[model samples]
Target: MTVTERVRPGVDAGRLMEHITALAAIGATPDGGVTRLAFSPEDVEGRAYVARLMAEAGLAVRVDPAGNLIGTRPGIDPGAATLVLGSHIDTVVNGGAYDGAYGVLAAIEVARTLAERGVRLACGLAVVAFCDEEGGHGTMGMLGAHGFAGALPPGIAKVLDERGVPVGDLLAAVGGDAERLPEAAWAPGDIAAYLELHVEQGDVLERRGVPIGVVESIAGRVNVSVTVEGVAGHAGTTSMDHRSDALVAAARVVLAVRAIAAEEGVVLRATTGTCSVGPGMWNVIPGRVRLGVEFRDVSADRLDAALARLAGAAGEIAAADGVTVTVEPGARTTPVACDPRLRDLVAGAARERGLDCHHLPSGAGHDAQIVARVAPIGMIFVPSEGGISHAPGEHTAPHHLVWGADVLLSAVLRFDEAPVARG
Candidate 1:
């Protein structure tokens, strides 16, 4: 019941900003963003840097086969489980700073605060930085946490990347022993709960004039790859009526996707992020095309129906154009509702800090979604300027960052005393 604001052991806003600034320089893009791919040399170095930071804070560090970094501070009671806090560090090509970095920094502040206060929980505490949440290497997104949770399949060790290099090989080189379970370093029962602090990748908080958004659920995401194939013909000689243009067929499907969302009367969204047309030259008629379609919604069933409609539309369009169409389901992850107890804890922290807070659903995917499956999970969101993310223009002012850290500090303290376990 005690709510007091004091400088937690290592909760230095200036120091946290310094860490973010230094990490940004590692994969520093020419356009003021970062481009470090997961499990690459750059990621290896970045992981090492974070490990060093954790070590200096007097935490023991270890890396699992899935490349997750876990830093633990032992508490007085060894029988109780540990509290885990983290987000992935790998970024999309040219991604912003606060997305994944803020969570790790906030966890570090938690460790610093606990150390300074000389407050030991009944259980241990761990700070983790998961690897490759972006799926940049074509491996499983949230692979690190998935492995830790025993959700990773046994055979995924041999999955190859774009360069035909096996994941097992890569993991071995990075000091992770690929055994029966990729995350042999830790088991599912070790973590009592997990929490992530991140920037709201949308304008939700700013639009509502709130400082913090307690996530209710992480939206489900599904990707469909649609391929349209039509017979090639001479561009100039073939009559418009006789020609079977794959590009034309693909365009119709794209329009249908947009139309489906508009007609559904639901909060559903679909996007074609990538497109490929064959025959490269302007004068050549396209014979084949590939489009990447991704759909997201708060409801999993609604997302399924929308994807089904999209597939049906693609089939109809291809039939009309005399083309062969194929739809392949790619990445699929369901929405995760935050642990209610932790959600209330976050709201209480915001209220104690005299900040406006609202309960919101996260539209973007995060490592916390994966962690929630194994541990009780909560998220604290800071407002994003103009709701921009995944770009160089993504911005969160320093004050927001500091405030978020303070809220995170309070939540950790609450969890430390009255532990909640999932069924």
Candidate 2:
């Protein structure tokens, strides 16, 4: 199972850490997480810094219409499609350094290493820094990948954050012209394959005492908003049976959702993120209640069954309480499985390096999921310290970072030698 390829000196861990540490300082939050919103001033400056580094590594860089940064290293064959290495540059509110940043940084390191040795492969390498993967304000994550995949445009026309700034307005503020946003998308034939390196984002690897993880599939997500309405009544004198408690209905809805998720199996997960009861909560029986429910799993059929059960339970509970329920389907995205060929390549590379590796499913969503729709996609993962992420305390040892990068390099080399697969 070992992929015996010529191994060059591994990337310098010191240099890799320096890049992440320095970029983290730009939008450092009070708690140590980063807050660089997409198409914001901080993002503009951060991207500029990355572009400069890419240039230093001998990459020909370009900024597309959607404000995505792409750096290309041309191979001997100019007619061949390009191998893409990319991830989002945006971060969640107070997110950690190793989240999206690690993928982009690792690509940069790989390009640098290749250039230092003057190694030229069959296909060109394109390092990409996708925009707005975090969806901090617009609720539109993976905007850049979606655009490139032809599913949607990267510049959304009329999305406003809490402060009233339109999504298009935000793009303009960061030197992105909305009129030219259509040029951001890529044709289906342009990409050879896509590879992403990211943090595990969970405690699985650390808990299992493994150094690296090769993701098998990315989980699909279903988000729903449920509102329960009932008659408002005075808490002082209204009898318990006479009063229609909206809060009680909402509570039951939450528990029912949890039950469906548990019954669905280990791959299925559910969460009731928000809940509210109207008026002063001290005494009055609430007249209205609102909540959001989200479900995720690797199997589409299983997810559908879970949602059906959840809907049934919610309706029954609301009917018993004399309350009406309204359900709004928020978002439905299919789970993406990584390219099996590329997955095997990564596993072989890890074994060649004498590293302990296993295949694991990613519970969190990623930019690679969008890319999977258009090209063969693969992801390499490193352990998250204490399985912590999206926080300042999130970390992975320097050695582990280098180890993952080494595996990535070997995998890329093996992929370069393989035949182009066309279906």
Candidate 3:
């Protein structure tokens, strides 16, 4: 096959776009975005639309007990492992159109092209639509991914959605049997490999003028909550030097989070995303404050070093401010490196298409990381306009989206066309 033909390989660009536009309309936002939060009515509608697309692509579709949608194209050899392609369809509040949706729709287009051409693989092709990838407004993020990995939390049945309704109930509303969630778990060999396509959600590719990124690793993330407590006093009556203020201490802790990272030349990014202060009234001096500090890095050692430095900083800040500071660590997940062979296939496809390919680590967490527990994983990234995501401005050009699919299809074909080995 000619290089151009191999790269494009009959992917219907217009049809691919049709799917994107249609899905974007389901949870349409007035400011040009979407909000199909997990388990929301809008999310149900969005998944239904994808199910229709999957069916039209000639795949047998079903929803797993954990609410993961799987559409499978039968293989030439029934005993062979399945090659899975996927991305979540749910979006964050006011999220842009292409974040998780592009990867999914693009995979369907690839499947449609393969089916129309009558090409069936030894390894069956399955497309997954993982639910709650954004964590359903913080009620346990990556729920579907954890479910598929058979790593779901024990308390899942008791977890509630944003509206205080049981998540299990919401899953049922979308055809999921929460009681049978274990049935969704795929054994180690069941999924031979997992591939995902997504927008970069950062500016690296765009700033470097690269259209495609071969993910080297998904960064490990750790979050810690720091609380500072002091005596509350009247804003007008208390002397600034004699009175204790938790907000002031918390602000210092927030700045120290960044200062430590920068001064130590720490590889991880440290952010204080939230600061809760009470009493909140303007006339009341704040007596308690909590700050959420999160750190992300490709190296676990680096993350540990960061935490150690944070502890020392907190001690100094607490003593200086005359307040008690406590640091409580939250979730900590190690980084997942992309499979070496698959990484090369994606890179080769990008080069074959004459697209500039860059290798980078993913800062944002994705389903691919969790799925890595059961199968080898790979990821492709198209440039996010200005590295924007989870907001109204998230964008990738029409052609960029198609090119990512082309690379995804080419990589899948390369893997399928090669000789197979079994343990």
Candidate 4:
């Protein structure tokens, strides 16, 4: 189908941009960034605004026990499995405007366009705004989606935030029943497919002059926490040859991380985003060092191999430096491949619109990765200018945003006609 032929009559570009602008104001920062951390007051207010928008768009809205916002529009066949579309709304501290909010607001726009035209399909449509995707309060990320997928760990209710408030209490504060979080899990077959529209968060599409990206896979991520213990001494008293410096060992590990990732392949990403030295003093030899290491790759085998190398390297470094090195693995999420049929549908949507589209892999983690456990999933990416994300500079041109929404609307319409299998 050509773009002109499938174009919905009333897909309002202005209204869509308006929604983005309005939501961007909730946690608006003086630096032109946003700070709506999960479960924060700004997050709650933002979700409330979304719920209101969902209601005004004529959908029945509800907040799940895990705090995910769900808005459902019944189909002609009410018993059919649902077509779910959405992205999270919570942002990283000082995050960009478009990262999570665009997908959500665009999903609403799709529903709004359909409702305005009185179009109902064979399958139901649902828009969801998952909670805590950015993992504030030191909790594992994608909490809401994890719960909905029946993947949330037990004792999650006891997990505390920075203020020592339990997750259950926080959920309550946001109008959710954390005690019933497990009840929020949807049966594996309930949803026919899941789709998300998000910024590319990279320069790939923009550099290629493409407006759309059909994601091939979402990369798997493994986080490792490392601590090195060594003797602390006065810098002047401890000669370089006699000193066992934890900071020096940690630095070697960091360098090894970079080298290992580079040796693995272009697809592998390794980072040490956080590092700290205890008793940090200009005149003192560091006694202890802590580092957070993260590895991401589309191939599980490659990630595993890289992880093994990292552990081995850490051990060797510790032995050479005369320090005790401990590597504690944290969250590990497997790579997710988008359903082939849905990928084609997304490409078709772009083709019909005469928009250039590229097939790519997402280096960043997303809620769609978690939701894929329950349903066949697909993702669409609009270009992010200058490859900027998680910062105030993140942006996609208004026209690009409109085009992305149009493509999403087209794909959703196509899915409604002949939905894919849930598995």
On lDDT, the candidate that comes out on top is 4
- What is the lDDT for 123 in model 3? 88
Candidate lDDT values, in order: 0.81, 0.82, 0.87, 0.90
Ranked by TM-score from best down, the candidates are 3, 4, 2, 1
Backbone clash total, candidate 1 = 2
Instruction: Give the runs in model 2 whose Cα sits over 4 Å from its true position.
Output: 1-5, 153-155, 264-267, 419-422
Q: After superposition, how far is residue 95 of candidate 2 from its true place, in Å?
A: 1.3
Clash count per candidate: 2, 0, 1, 1
Model 3 lDDT at residue 52: 92
Residue pairs in clash, model 1: 9-113, 10-112
* lDDT of each residue in 1-423, candidate 2, tens digit only: 233535556676789889988888878899878888787677888888889888987899887655578899877788888899979778877888888888898888888887886778779899999878888676478877776676664347566777777767766665555677667767767888899999898878888888779999999988988999988888999998797888988998988888777764633688899887797477788999999899899888877877777778878987899998887778998998898888888888788788888789998999899988788889999999888887778888888888898888887788888834634
- For model 3, residues 177-233, the per-residue Cα lDDT tens digits are 889989889988888788999999999998999999999999998999999998898
Cand. 4 TM to true fold: 0.96
Please give, for residues 217-266, the per-residue lDDT of candidate 1 as tens digits. 88998888999999777888999999889999999888877776776644
Candidate 4 runs further than 4 Å off: 1-6, 264-267
